[model samples]
Target: MSPDQFHDRMWEILQDINKNEFHAVAAKPPTDKAIANLATSTGIALPKDFLAFSQKTNALCIMAREELWPEAKLFDVGPAWTFHRGLVILGIEAEDLPEWANIQNAYESLVELYELTDVLPLLKIMGDGNHYWGVKQDGTFVEVFDGEATTLECSFIDTYATEIKELIQRQKDMCELITKRNKKQH
Candidate 1:
């Protein structure tokens, strides 16, 4: 079965088990093992090394000062599959760094690189760690002094099928570019 179908079925099963209250804290896919179990029971092969993304702590701070509190929105930036202001994250493989970097560069370039916003260097988050950055509510890039970094984390929390779909598309796009580049060199 298609992966979406597989996952939808799994959700349905969970819904059935939860008596349709899927939002209960104990019901959603809380851990990788739990998610894998659902996939397995539903006869869906888990995507290899699936990543769960969590938001950076610094970003959480900005989110806390909000007028609405924890009800922030995902940015609608180009290249983003989805946006969440509180704690945005995605899971990608270390082996996929080149493609990830290309996508990152594409995002930075699309934002006009340093002209429109300063792209802080990727940072290793410290303690309960994840990485994030703040755009001042006033439309300015959050400034970073030398040796400073934007934070990020790989903690798995909310998982979206769109992220999986978008990542698949990125590989397709990269391969097509590689083929075109290779043909030119040959």
Candidate 2:
């Protein structure tokens, strides 16, 4: 699935789950100039599709700010939210280092470990402690778990959509089970 199509489907699922009460918390998509600046500042030649995705809309920060999936403890939204703010928080182009020591340290480690010049971090698996979904310069999708990189089965955009749909279904199943158990108790 294309990035836009994936996002549209996710929104549909989220809306159905929340009874259309939840709204997007992300601001408009970042401008092309902003995306280019982010690439230059981070010293990574980001994938064109990734830039296209970012331009479509900010990553899912709404779920982070709000407890969209209260029962789904497996869904950690922190990384997704924070990663979207990477350029701002990391101060990639700043003359001096970022004031936040931890942020600076983590940024350096990521840049060095991944040699971000060759691979760009696309999305972080927030719920799964210290894992990331990234894209290589050659357009291959990679999963970084515990700092080890593994190539994904297919393109990042399509795989991301498929995984997200499955995850949502899992959460829905869990919710149904919870509801049935609660009804029985009553």
Number of the top candidate by TM-score? Answer: 2
**Each model's total of backbone clashes:** 8, 0
lDDT (0 to 1) per candidate:
0.28, 0.48
Write model 1 residue lDDT over 1-186, tens digit each, in one string: 544454344344332222121121111223455345433433333232221211101111111112221231455233322122221222111323333222133224324523433332121111112222322223223323232333323211112223223333443454465477679999
Compared with the true structure, the alpha-carbon lDDT of candidate 1 equals 0.28
Off by over 4 Å in 1: 1-159
RMSD of each: 19.4, 7.7
> What's the C-alpha lDDT at position 177 in model 1?
51
Colliding residue pairs in candidate 2:
none
Cα displacement (Å) at residue 122, model 2: 1.4
Residues 49-128 of candidate 2 have per-residue lDDT tens digits of: 44554455444432222332342345434324322211111122223332331222333556676554444555543344
